[model samples]
Target: MSLSMILPMSAFALAASISPGPVNLVCLSSGTRYRLSQGLIFVTGATLGFIALFIAIGLGLYSAMNVMPGLQALLRWAGVAFLVYLSYRLAVDDGRLTEGDTHKAPGFMTGAVMQWLNPKAWLASASGIGAYTSGNDLQQVLIFASLYMPICWLSLASWVYAGAFLRRYVQRPQVLKAINRILAALLLASCVYLVLE
Candidate 1:
């Protein structure tokens, strides 16, 4: 891909990754409750998941969905159900600092699954692939995925860092619980937004 192709692709990847979404929200929660390294693991998984999804969409998943219209609905409802489950988990959090790895914080699998279940990920992949690629060309698809990986990683990492910073101030259980609840609510709201949109 040329510089013209790369710049916009990079910007799209960064914006989509950095913007508040289910994965980013989960990363924030993980950062607040787990070690920074743990949060980064989740971020890495999420970035990989997104790149995989992007590549799949670019390769032919978008056309498949169009041919099998129900595929879209299936993805949508699956994403909604997953978000509800995650939101419930967040909502019922005990609101205590993990301080270590004993809390069973979200790990690589959860991060990957979360990205697959995230409607925002699907949309970002579809839209970015559609806008940036041409005719499902392997070269373009791979180039876009390559551009997306690090930009997405760093953008989501920044959210995790922001949450870690907030952790310092939310030393009290009530404050942390409130933050969790707010994040939970936002997750649910994203679900609703996805369904409605």
Candidate 2:
């Protein structure tokens, strides 16, 4: 691919990868509630989700999904329900860290599974594949996948770690509550968009 295409594609991927969504919020919450390592685990899961999504997209699953109304509806509803459930949990969570909660980081597999149900993630990946995938051969697709995963992993992990670090500076109840409220609202709003989209 030419530099012109590569640059724009990279920008698109980076923007989508770093943007605020339910997954990002969950990672931030995980970081704040537990530790940075836990937050990274969530990032790992999300990365795997993206990898799987890209593979499926490469294999024409998304194209198939687009033609099947029933499958599309199922994915949409599942994403909506999952986001709402997560938001409710965040909204009411006391922000109280249990003893040794640092050791309780989320598992990578769980994070990966969560991404499957994330509407924003599906939308973003579909968008990325449409906009970025230029090469047609197996090697080219593999190259695309190889380059995409680590960039995604690092970008997301950084956001989660930033959240964990920020938590140290805002150890007041009011501030934490405000943060949680903001995140919950963002997640819910995203869910509304996902359901409608």
Candidate 3:
């Protein structure tokens, strides 16, 4: 890829990764509940998942997706279901620091699956690859994925850190519960938006 192509691709990756979405929201929630150390695992998984999606798109999966309308519909519904489940989990959480709470924090697989189920993730990957690369060149696809992965990680980690910072001030159980509830509501709202969109 040329420098001109790299510049626009970088800008798009930054914007897409930094934007508030399901993945970022989940990262924030994880950071608030578990802080950065554990939260980094989730961020890593999400970034890797995005990189995989970008590679798939760049390797002509996006065109295949366009041909299969039913596949997209299935993915959308799956995304809605996953988001709803996440919202419920967040809503019922008590925000107490239990001995096993660390284990309860979402792990790498959850983060990876969440990105796969996220429609915005799919759109961003497909659009970025489509706009930046020509045909299904593996080299170009790898280049795009390589550029995007770090940007995704940094954007998500920033959200996690922001949540960890808020954790310091929101230590009270009631306040933490309120914050979780708000985050749950936002996740639920995102589900609705996803379905409607």
Candidate 4:
């Protein structure tokens, strides 16, 4: 790829990664409850998941599924279900910060699997690959993945730290409730977008 292509692609990837979405919310919650080390694991897993997603899309799997409206619907429902589950957990969190309150950071395998069920992850990966990838050249796809995934990882970390910084102020019951509600609403909106799309 030309320098022109690479720079623009990288910029696009970074913007997409940094945008507010389900994964970022989850990372934020994780960071607030736990430590950055655990939050970074989530970030790493998510980044690898995006890299794998780019590979799958490059292999034409996403396009094949894209052409099948039924498959798309199935994917949408699956994403909605997963998001609802996540939102419920967050919304009902008790106003306590006991030791071991945080769940374990999902492993790389879980993160990779969640990509298949996360609508935002799908949309972002599809958008990045669709906009930047040229032809089916594996090398180019790998190049894109290599450059993009680290941006995603770092962007997620930034959000996690931002959340951690805000956690002190937001841990108050009313503030946490509002934050949880916002997350739930966003997840619901994501679900609606998936079905409508």
Candidate 5:
């Protein structure tokens, strides 16, 4: 791809990756609730999942939706249900700062599976692919995915870092619980958009 194309593609990738979504919310919660290293694991899985999804969309998975319209509905409802389940878990976290290590962080498989089930991930990949790529240009798609991988990881990591930073102040169980509830609410709101659409 040309410089012009690459810049736009990179910008799109940055925007999509940095924005708050289910993956970022989980990363943030994980950071607040567990170790930064644990959150990074989820970050890695999410980034890799996004890269895979983006490349698939670029290669023709997005077109598959057109051929099988029901697939879109299936994905939509599944994403919504998954988000609701995640939100419920986030909202009910009762651990204190001292118990951070005791509370399990979301694993790599959870992150990857969450990305696959996240409506935001699907939309971002489909829209970015549609805007930046030409018809089945594998080279361009690969280039975009390469650019996206690091950007996505770093962006999500920032959320984790932010949560870790908050950990210093929100040392009380009550405060941490409030934060989790807020994140959960935001997560639920995110799925509402998917449902509405």
Candidate 6:
């Protein structure tokens, strides 16, 4: 890709990476409940997942989806189900700050799996790959992924930092629970939007 082409591709990656999606929301929740160092695992996993998806799409996964119409629908519904489940988990959090509370924050696998199941992630990957390259050029795809991965990680970390910053002010359990509920509601709303859109 030329430098001019790369600029537009980078813009697309930045917009998609920084947007309010399931991965970002999860990172926010994780950072709110865990230390930044611990939350880095989730960020890493999510970034890796996005890179995988971008490569897969560039290598014809997007074409495959077009060939099988039902596959898209299946993936959409699966994403909806997963988002609903996550929203429920967030909604029911007790917001207790206990030492060694491993269960409180979601782990690396959760972050990785979330990107695979997220409709927005799929759409963004497809759009980026479809728009920038021929969708079968491995070299261009690798370049795109390499550029996007760090952008994605840094964007996700910003959400985590925002949540961690809020944590300091959320001294009361009730307040923390309220914040969790709101985040859960946003996730649920995203589910509805995903289905309708």
Candidate with maximal lDDT = 1
RMSD of each: 1.3, 2.2, 1.3, 2.1, 1.5, 1.4
Worst 10-residue lDDT window for candidate 6 reads 96-105
Write candidate 1's Cα lDDT for 85-179 as tens digits. Answer: 88998899888885755457887877887887788888899999888888889999998898899999999999899899999877888888899
The per-residue C-alpha lDDT of model 3 at residue 163 equals 87
In model 1, which regions exceed 4 Å deviation? 101-103
Q: For residues 1-197, what per-residue lDDT tens digits would candidate 3 score against the true structure?
A: 68988889889999999999988988888878894778899999999988887788787787888899999899889999999988998899898644346877888988898888998898898888778877888898898889999999999999999988888777877777888899999999998898788
Please give the range of 10 consecutive residues that has the lowest summed lDDT in model 2. 134-143
lDDT of each: 0.87, 0.75, 0.87, 0.76, 0.87, 0.86
TM-score of candidate 1 to 2 decimals: 0.95
Q: Give the TM-score (vs. native) of candidate 3.
A: 0.95
| 4-96: candidate 5 lDDT, tens digit per residue | 998898899889989888898998998898888888998998888878888888889989988998988898888889889989988888847
lDDT of 6 by residue, 18-118 (tens): 99988899888877777777678899888898899889988988888999999888988988999999899889988875547776577777778888898
Prediction 6 global C-alpha lDDT: 0.86
CA lDDT of 194 in candidate 3? 82
Q: What C-alpha lDDT, on a 0 to 100 scale, does residue 57 get in candidate 3?
A: 76
Residue 160 displacement in candidate 5 (angstroms): 0.3
Task: Report residue 123 deviation for candidate 2 (angstroms).
Answer: 2.3
What is the TM-score of each predicted model, taking all chains together? 0.95, 0.88, 0.95, 0.88, 0.94, 0.94
